[model samples]
Target: MNTQEQTQLNMLKKALMQSQYATVIAQCDDVLASLTSPEAMREARYCKAVAYRLSGQPDLALHDLQQLVTDFPDYGRAYQEQGYCYQRQGEDQNATYAFYQATRFNPALLAAWQQLEQAYQRDNQIRALQLAQQQISFLTSLPKPLLGATDLLHDGQLFKAEQVCRQYLQANKHDAEAMMLLAEIGMQLKVYSDAEFLLESCVTLYPDNDRAAAAYQALLSKLGKFPQAVKQARRRLQNQPHNMTIQAGLAHALVGVGALNEAIELYRTLLADQPARPALWVALGHALKAAGDTVGAIEAYQQAARQAPDFGDAYWSLANTKTYRFDDAMIESMVVAQHGSTVKLEDNIHLCFALGKALEDNKQADQAFSYYQRGNALKRKTLRFDISRTEAALEAQQQACQAPMFAQPGGCHAPDPIFIVGLPRAGSTLLEQILASHSMVDGTMELHDILGIANSLSHQGNAYPFNLARLSDAQCQALGQQYIEQTRAYRNGAPFFIDKMPNNFIHIGLIKRILPKARIIDARRDPVACCFSGYKQLFGEGQEFSYSLRDIGRYYIAYEKLMNHWHRVLPGQILTVQHEAVIDDLTGQVKRLLAFCELPFEQACVDFHVTRRVIKTPSSEQVRQPIYRSGMTQWQQFEAHLGPLFDVLGQRTNR
Candidate 1:
């Protein structure tokens, strides 16, 4: 909502409290008509419902509340208001259930907690009563600012919550809970290094705080520090031997570090005791997929669907194989599950993406696009991908990375690392597989070392690329060596290794400053094909731009412009490998790639499909098979629906 709309909304709330029901409903309708944001629409409906109830129209109020919760199942305020409607109608059981849902969605809802506490106590539910009482007591005991911030956070006002929490933390230095709240805010804001520091300090200051320890472990996993995540998870498991959640987290970290066999075993052991858990089944499927056991992965995914027909992640996991096709019955099940009143927001998103892929595989192009659009629309809600921020960073790179920065002999002379940089779905993984097939090259999953270094620099008051200008040659050399040491764990006694983090295209200037002797390959693909492919795939994390077609299109344009700038300032330093060219002439492309990297051409590089390694990208399965023409022209079918993508791209390949 805009400033005027927000002010009107506040006024409507005041009118509602003053018993001006008609005024509240009319103004809410006006606000709803003007408000385009999903959050604003929900707020308007919620206020209107309260107005209906206050004006003695219980049926209308219940109708509105039902629709509100139906559309947004996780709307805790709707649930709380629905509970009130039920309570007014003397429907005690319904009111209690609605209150339960309210608290389930938002534990910070004080009114909901108090109601639940009363309901539990009256029903003689001792355990439940104690839990509710504890929640109420804890909430009431918090400092007023923190309590307000908690409410704002739960209500999706992240910026406001951050501002309030930061203010509170400024006053209450080193308060564990305050630090935790700030850390949470930082994470939501995508300020990872700050969150890491806050959580790390919290854990160090209060060693006994398992909550802080667990948060730190989760962050480590998120940042792709798998070995550290493994250590953190193991420490937690030691403290709580039977904690299945921690063990499962450890299994995840194990998988991250290419310990697939061990991770698979751990998942199997967990499933053995909890066979009914669909999440365990889904997670097991991921490990199996990464281990190249496509058949086993399918079985695990199918079993998960069988266990819970409504489990969207299970269906999405199956579709993510890029080889699986959903049968009619499974599609029907998915459609039913998605429309169910209690389908979780996360589950709904999975279902949309899963359905999109399934329909696409079945050759229903228009229908597939519809689901893809819905999936992207839903995913966009939870992200913080600012295309402008990315563009600004790229602009800074162009301005800072002049020819002068590269004149001196600076960075580490280690020529071991080969960096494959590009957008996701631009064939970086395929190139990595081909290169790693060579005798001297090792294949590593997308490494966060460079991004982490840039993030660290940005956090230390000097942002990346800009920071490069101030660094002496010695400093650059030290950073370059630091990267080598950081990535040593992923090497297999090979003279060269591939860091195929696609988004590293944005950090070419940073990579140059640190690793001057490193081989840089730009994995180029058709603009339409690359953007559409990214839009369809459900990546585990990062690449937030993929959630929207226009955002991704803009990102690609920004990347292309940056690459052009890099080439201008550092001529002949980067090689561009076009995906289509590679598909058309594999041998010629292999020769070209090998020549650029100064490696001997080998038959194994041409036969990359037979090269065995831990591949994790969406194209992993496809790359395991021989090169095919299908991927090259797959975007054509969705050409009619590509306007959103192409609108941002000034030109598109002839359809």
Candidate 2:
């Protein structure tokens, strides 16, 4: 290679390391065009392909990798790259074939073996463990016992796996997998510092390992260092440009940092390359919806559903797009029937609840009630909670709020927020839509900011128990400020914001402590009705609470107890919004709700359907329609079927 060529190559390499994908591609393209030596030409093409992959252009990367392997048949790395590209494109068979070829060409390519294992895992093939075992057997000299620990870890035995990893690290302290396993264990245990140190070591030892990079970025995100995580993800993408996982991580980081437009662009590019990836399509739909392009978002979700018909996420996304309650029953039925045969109990519950709401909205009260009963039966088996454990915490929080330990000295300068708290199916979403329609309020559906702050504080030893009374006055004030700051990212200078996480009922004590001045609305419904409603819907993530009926009933009881406690301790701090009452007197209830929120009544509040704000809840369809009486007294028809739940709910039955 000439001096000029070497310099140009060096510059291209630097660009690739920096994740300047476009610059690297341009440099490589020029280098390949001018290359005289066959070796140099092949190398340049490979570099170009890497750059293209990093830039979220997987098809171009695949084309280049395929041409490289064809021309340089003995190049094992070329085959490995081709396999990875194929995997990203969901051509699992082709990916496996390419990995096999790479292994045949070079038995020492452990990365190819790992990729093969992942492809099998993705396909949920039982033979994946056997394949991994086979690959482990091929290693002439095991680097460390950590390899075995990884095998156990991958099989889901975290405690045993971590023990094995710790044993391995005692002898060989520098084992990257051992370090990473420790990190995983730490994360699971909520030991942030231990996880961070272990991840940092793993990344340092194996900079080219995309898994290590991803883990590091995840830890960073968990620690609330989103910008740094984004930077690290971008850097990793430079070398593994065609890496879909990294692309997704980058998009998520961008969203975390409020770089929505850039995240949208990156997601679009990823979707264009891997059009059939339902998760990617769902993400794109969310990004588009957040960007105020509801039509575009709906189309994206529909395309996702068409590509992966059984994917629960796509159905959930579709259910959240329609502009009227009239379509709610149809969407719910479709989702339920689509996933009915599976053992996914939560999805069944979610769908049933959705169906009940839809039927009630359509004035098919008898059918809705039947579904509501089925839903409640399922919930009683699925959802569970410890009321005694939570109530103690609520009492403590009430005392702290009354004592004014954390009250802002000059009085709260922050905007008053209308917080909607309940179980998922208790009409919190609808309340937010009505409130958001008023000129003084902006409904930010189910903001994670409050929960994120609470979680962080809990992890940081702030001495605040899960219940309210345990919080010191100072701690409560700090929590409030932290919540406001975190939510500032989602706030668009609106006078008031609605934090409508149904599960936020669990944190009502802490919420009252922090935002004593804020208005809280407990969206109450018949216990059987609410539990049943939660049974038929399919939540895509983090809903371990809805997998069984007993759990659901227990959860409801805990929520109710906490809400009742709030009423006793923080009188006038909260208002009760009955879902049935809303149905019976839409305008009157809405007027009262507006008065509670301290917002002037506007005609828009009654005609909330005309507002173009993005709705992120399962009730999105219902909220976009005008008020109706169909949802009132919806549990009557299923009275025979829901006897057990009715018995449990007892005198608390709102009906």
Candidate 3:
């Protein structure tokens, strides 16, 4: 949207808030016509719909609300407005459903909660009534400004939410809920350290508050503080022994810490009592798959699908196994579920990806790509990744950390970590598996401490790569030591450990500043093959670019540009390992890798497929067997559908 249109939208929103309904409704169309962005259009339409309903045009309001909700399925305010329209029209059932949807998409919609409370009480929906009552009570009890801030937070207006919360907290520093809400906004903004500090203060002040405890546990987990998360979860469970949520949280923490047996047992125990919960089944399936029991994982995933036919995660979980082939009946069921009444955006995305995989396995290339594209389009709606931010960060790294910056690097000199940095789906995991096969090397899951530290450091006054050059030797050593201390729980006593975090390629400068002696490997692949592979797969978190073909291709180009900068700056510091080279000459590549890391040659690294460890990546199943030639040229089959990707990647495929 242009500045003038955005300014008009801001004015229209204020006018609506002030009950200037005629003005808001009149100005919305002109403001919307000039606004080209989907988000801007959504905001304008919502304002118009709300204004129409308040101005006594119930049918007209419902018409626009219906269109708005259709276009932006996850817009909670649109559903809320739809509820108000339905209520005014005396369509009680429709109002009830709309209010329920509003609350589901955004729990901070106080009016929706109030409406649902009344509807549930009237209709005798006992479970829903209790939930609605709880939600309404929570929302109603908040301070008025915090309440507004809460709604803003739910509506994706984080800047406004932060402003309100900061103003309120300036006078009411000890308000726990306000503190929690602000901390949550910080998390949304990726200001992890600030969020951690706020959550810690909130929890310390209100030790008995379950909400504070829950939020603290969540933030801890998100930052990869798994042991701390486990501790918090255990404490919460101790306080409420029968709380299934706390039990599940602990199970997830256990999985994060690689205590798979305990996590699996905990999930099974939760399932024995609550077998009807499809989410629990899927969680158990994840644990089982991470532990390499594919059969048990399949059974768990299938049971979840059977329990809730519209639960798309279960079907996607099955497809994500990388080796699972869906039967005709299963595919038919997924098709029906995709079109089912309870289908939502996430379900549609999951079903599309699963169906794409099913069709691809059956050699239906065109149909497979169609589903993949649909899934990517839907998935992109749910992410907020910015290619511009990525490019800016890369440019800043180049500007801040040149050869002179590396010259002053007197870091911790810790030779313990071997960092594997690259783009996802570029065979980083395969390299980790091979190196981990060496007796001196321990294969930890893609550790998050590096990214977490980078995030925390970025919150400093100057941001990350720029601030990195200012750290003194002592400060750099302390930060590097902090990393070692934080990641100690994930490692065994091996002299060397592999930290195969692919996106760490972007943080190479920071890595050099902290751990100057660390072994860095840059995993590379054929651009088209890597981009297409990433586009088709669904990641659990943080590889948002993979959701779209053009985005993934552009990310690759950007990644290559940054890596080239690193190579020029650091000379022989980073070893660029092509995925194809390793596949073709395992022995030769293994020896070369060991030579770089200063490890003696080991035959086990060459025969890495047989070395058993818990692999958690999507490549787990494929990397467990010997290398093959089949997947290298698989992108050629879908070449006809990859026009945008080819344009973005400059047609880098050998084929």
Best by TM-score: 3
Candidate 3 lDDT over 264-367, as tens digits, reads 99999999998999999999999998888989999999999999998999999999998999999999999998887668778889999999999999999999
Where does model 3 exceed 4 Å of error?
Answer: 1-3, 10-26, 36-38, 51-60, 88-90, 652-654
What is candidate 2's local distance difference test score? Answer: 0.68
| Model 1: per-residue Cα lDDT over 1-655, one tens digit each | 5787687678888998899999988788767878777777888899999999889887899998988876666678889998998999999888988888888777789999999888988899999999999999989998999888888777777899999999888898999988888888788777888999999999999988988998999998888888889988988888898999999999999988889999999999999998999999989999999889999999999999899988999999989888998999999999999888667777888999999998998999999989998988877766646789988988888998898888877888899999999999999989999999999999989998898888878766576668787888898899999999988877888999999998788788888888989999999998989999999987788888888889999999999999999999899999999999999999999999999999998999999999888887888888899998888788899988888788899776565
By the TM-score metric, which is better: model 2 or model 3? 3
**lDDT for model 1:** 0.88
lDDT of 2 by residue, 1-655 (tens): 4666666677777888899999888777677777775556666777788888778888999988867765655566677777878777888888887886776655556787787777677778778657665874755255556555554444334577688878878988777766777888777655666787788888888887767888999887766566678999989988888888988988977766657789899999988887889789888888776655767878887787678555655555654553424364456545556355432444455456556656656767777666655654555433223444444655554444443333334223365677898888788888888888877787765765566555555555445443345555576677777777766655567788888877677666566667767788889886777776665455544444554445566667756766776677666778899988888788999989988877888988888877877564667667766766555554555555555555555634434
Q: Which ten residues in a row have the lowest lDDT in candidate 3?
A: 646-655
Return the lDDT, model 3, position 633.
Answer: 88
- Residue 193 miss distance in model 3 (angstroms): 1.5
> How far off is residue 435 in model 1, in Å?
1.4
Candidate 2 weakest ten by summed lDDT = 403-412
- Model 1 misplacement above 4 A: 1-10, 17-19, 29-46, 58-75, 86-105, 113-141, 384-386, 462-464, 652-654
TM-scores for the candidates: 0.91, 0.62, 0.96
